[model samples]
Target: MFHVLGALVFTLVGVRDATWTTDGMAAALLVAGSIGVAGNVAYGFDSVHVALGDTSLVDQAGAAVLIKPLGLFFPLTMLLCAVAVRHVAPRWAAVVIGLSALAFPVANIGNIPALGVAVGVATVVGFGALAMRPVRSPSPATPAASAAG
Candidate 1:
């Protein structure tokens, strides 16, 4: 979830660096973030039951049919955002994202302590790096241009 937010920030920063305004990259990030957020929210409703291996929580009308697939969209969009911003983001940020993606399985699925630490570091550094980047505003027009106008 935080990873998805970090990706959004990275894209916004990249777009800002160019002109300090929204652009195509910003639009794409918004769309991706929307899909991811929606999926995550829907999945949250069934997460506890799913984690507990209790299928009874699901109603007979197949209300939970979209749970798994939607939940998967969160990570998929995060990855998509990472890839989309890689060329524009700092190299270190990109590297951190890559490490986090790789360590996700060991950290969350396998419950490996060592890999968990790696995932933690990658997440903290990646989000921190993106968050800490300074947004450079476009320079004001020169006096000559104003005078000419």
Candidate 2:
């Protein structure tokens, strides 16, 4: 998913955030969210077969395992990623990422009188491009290192 790829851009930050807790938590949330998304899609497809009065107990179980991980874990992952990005990237990159995140959801309002989903998606693509730079944060200056150089 785009969100996960976007999150990976913050890996350097996640590892170097002066705390291992964030890195561990981000990894946990990423795995949980990914599993949740895969499972949700699997269950959703199975549940769809129940619509034509051809319900099976196994297929019907989709309703039970549907929303939790997707609703809870995925957003948490995004939040973690956003926080991670803030520490490593410039302020403007943070703003662009934030805008792109918001753009995805607003894109669903396709029939709105003024703006359309296309505009929203375009915003995400454009802003995401601006935000995703390849460089990691430069190492901090140390007296010995600076003197040596």
Candidate 3:
């Protein structure tokens, strides 16, 4: 559920940024973030029930050692970004919700597959949305004739 929610946030942010900003780079970031969300979801779908040390995709010799560390650092990064972008678009909502998703993964350090998915979705969605906002257009001026009359 958290993973799904994170993906939703990411998509919404991407769509918002693509629509509002002229910066191609921001749009690209959103795209990358979206991909991240998709990847996380796929990972969850493939292996959500395997118990630890029972042999699964991540059971490859050094894989667990390498990947588990990511869980530790990744959440910190996400939390930093969330804090750093509080003044930005999507603001606190994205930050808070995203942090919520990170709770499980950070706590379990990626040991819990389901938690990993949750954090992945939440981070992308929250960060992606925060980076983009709708552009506002100025109102047209009233006619001179109307004002003079």
Q: What is the C-alpha lDDT profile of model 2 across 3-113, one tens digit per residue?
A: 344444434333333232244555664565465445434434444556556664343455644543343443333344445455455556555545544543344223353
Root-mean-square deviation of Cα positions for candidate 2 versus the true structure, in angstroms: 8.1
Which candidate leads in TM-score? 1
In terms of lDDT, which candidate is stronger, 1 or 3?
A: 1
Count backbone overlaps in model 2: 0
Model 2 misplaced stretches (Cα beyond 4 Å): 1-22, 39-65, 99-123, 130-132, 138-149
Weakest lDDT window of 10 consecutive positions for candidate 2: 12-21
Model 3, 45-120: lDDT tens digits are: 3354353434453455654444334334434434433433343345455456557645845545446778657655
> Each candidate: what lDDT?
0.53, 0.44, 0.47
Candidate with better lDDT, 2 vs 3: 3
lDDT of 1 at 96: 76
- Cα shift from native, residue 105, model 1 (Å): 5.9
> Residue 89 of candidate 3: its Cα lDDT?
47
- Per-model TM-score on C-alpha atoms: 0.52, 0.41, 0.39
Candidate 1 Cα deviation (angstroms), residue 132? 1.7
